[model samples]
Target: MRSTLPTFNEVWQRQCRSSILSDEKQFFSKNTFLVACSGGMDSMLLLCLLHCLFPQRVRAMYVNHQLQPDNEVWATFVQNFCEWHNIPYLIKKVQVAKGNLEAQARHARFNAFQQTICSEEILVLAHHQQDQAETFLLRLFSGAGVNGLKAMQKIAVKENIKIWRPLLDVPREKIEQWIKQDSIPYVTDQTNFDEHYDRAWARHTLWNVIKPRFPKMQTAITRTALLMQDADEILYEVLQQDFKCCGNENSLDIQALNDLTPARRRQLLSWWLKTEYRPSLDTVDRLQNEVMYARTDAQAQFFVKPFWYVRYQGKIYRLTEQQKKPKQYEIEIFDCQNIVLNQKYGLNKDLLKESLMLYPRIGGERVHLHGRVGTWPLKKAIQEAQIFPWQRDQIQILKKEDVILGIITPQGFWLAQSDYCVPNGWLPKLDGVSV
Candidate 1:
């Protein structure tokens, strides 16, 4: 009555056939397939499958987000399972900064995998059909458009990590049956039944409603998810065209945006948010609606917590750092208070508060560089001197009496004459800070 473990060749052919390495018999990258094991039934089954297939190639990682007291217990369960099977595993601990436990835990796990996995590796997750179905229902309740409702793909990637879901086509019932047949024990998280969370409540409630009425709701939703992926492809193509004329993923052309049809525009914005920004459709409306209409001149920003705002001359522009450009006039450094600056900018101690008759470099302007033999056009000297951009704004023109000594362009902090530059190791402290 026991379920038979498939041969490595059999399992590889079944799942990995669609992989880019057309010939499985050929050389394949041997980096570990990091499995994010949660000690739950789905993840346990995934671990069992990988163990049955290629135990040596898989590395199970169970991250304790340190939220629930049982988190440590879960880590132990995964660790024991790995040790018993002679499989390599790593137990990681993380602290969830904010948001719901499930969401934060998942984020922490993926972040760990990405950080730990080398560039050549990929991560496997056990998000099965039930999760996919639940996600779809959740998206519906949340009023998510196409991409959200599309649900998680079988093979998807975020940042540098690849997420594989080989069991999406395998039902929960099948997983349970397979576990029972194979004698694979799995620990269930008690929080799944807690009605305090919407997801917990919806698992029992949403399926109960759809199963009786539609009977084939899961299948239909799965099919719709597939169709949505196809639609997403087309939508991305449209976005490519739109962005080409306007701009990239982050910067959208405000003028051209007004030209898009309301519905198409909404979809375009939705695509950008779901892809570029957060995974779910959490802030699609804010990005396309309130944040969009809030006006660049209205002084509203998308990332208010981070102190970033949007400014509009003709269209919306994101301004980070809550920074105000002070009236940028010539700072006659002769002022008392030190040159207090919010950010690092061009500063030349050589040019500070001096009565040097500094004139802007013109063609006829010439100055004798101290180390050099003869006088050259101050412009040519600056070019030869290698003055940097930031230093150009505050370059020193050390003229004794209406004559150019030399300029202090960033080009390696030039001193025109021997008297121009302060002597090396000169102890000139400024306002309590060392020069």
Candidate 2:
């Protein structure tokens, strides 16, 4: 009687050499992991593989983006799959905002998964070599630089999450072959054939044409991406030494930047734009002309939209203009998990300081500044605090009893989440330092 979990585990061990896998690393212990399963063939196989290899260390996680007509059906299918095998499964429903269809859905999905990941858990994605090649071609067509052309990396991080794409080395054809050989039941997403989406079009049409012409293109991609990643590592090392910072909040020291060759400077700038901000190429081009080309000025601001990045005083600052605009709020509360939403300049730790409180953006709320005169309404005070309008209500002012902390601004900062209480003589760093 061969158990289903064991069969899945074998596939995982054979296909993906996750060191957190038992036999793969002889000396060290295997680290635990969570697999992101979409109920699609690729991820279903992924779930089975993980269960087969390291059942105790692996958990299947399904995120319902609520986009597909079969969303609930798919979730139910996954639930039944997990239940039959006695595997632990988590189903997370994310309210995907309608616009930027792909991007918004992806962000929401990742955010929910990120919320689930802890220091002990790593996330595995079933992105195969076809995905790798498709990503590369897509980046090339989009006129992406070295990083984009390099495409998907084997492993990456977001916040506290570790994302691993072990199947990057394996072709999608191989996965399909295995599924068939194993007699695995899988769902086919009909939308994959639609040409409206660029990636879908690329996968269905362009891949056949380009793959044959190049023949050994996958090897070239692998080698070139490796070289690029290596070069990028060195560039990052320099950035770490010279810029001394990371994240979307890029504060580049122009004086230091000027020391590098024009090409190096451009590369660094491009890196910041693509990797850190994920801005449009038009935005990047505009930035090069507006901010990077001329002498760095203190007040000359390049209003990088969505992600508020400004070049000022020979430094790059990633803060939303929402900080400068006014905000309105009303109080409410809900029992919630601990989470940190980033705000302008700094990150606010969303600990359960006292209790959970929710508040909608409304007209009346007071912000009490320490060194300033008296308190003012949250709206008026944000004008003083320079909080942006779009970012209002992002900050949940937790109220237990009669106390009100500052609200959670959209940028992830707790902007006075507990009243604009800047401790005495504590000078903060970055652009908005209230020393």
Local distance difference test, each candidate: 0.62, 0.64
Estimated TM-score for each candidate: 0.67, 0.66
Instruction: Give the distance in Å from residue 122's predicted Cα in candidate 1 to where it truly belongs.
Output: 1.4
* lDDT assessment of candidate 2: 0.64
> Cα RMSDs of all predictions?
9.4, 12.6
Number of the predicted model whose lDDT against the real structure is largest: 2
- For residues 1-435, what per-residue lDDT tens digits would candidate 2 score against the true structure? 334643533654555556435333542245677889888889877777767656687888889888788888888988888888877889999998878777788889988888887677778888887788777777777777665666777777767677777677777777887787677666777778888888799888887787889877766776677677787777777765544532234467666777877666666666666544456657766766667565644344577545556565455666655554435444544433433234332222333444545556556767653334666676776665564334554445544456554445543333343432323311122222121
Clashing pairs for model 1 are 370-416, 386-411, 387-410, 387-411
How many clashes does the backbone of model 1 have? 4
Lowest lDDT 10-mer window, candidate 1? 425-434
Q: What is candidate 1's local distance difference test score?
A: 0.62
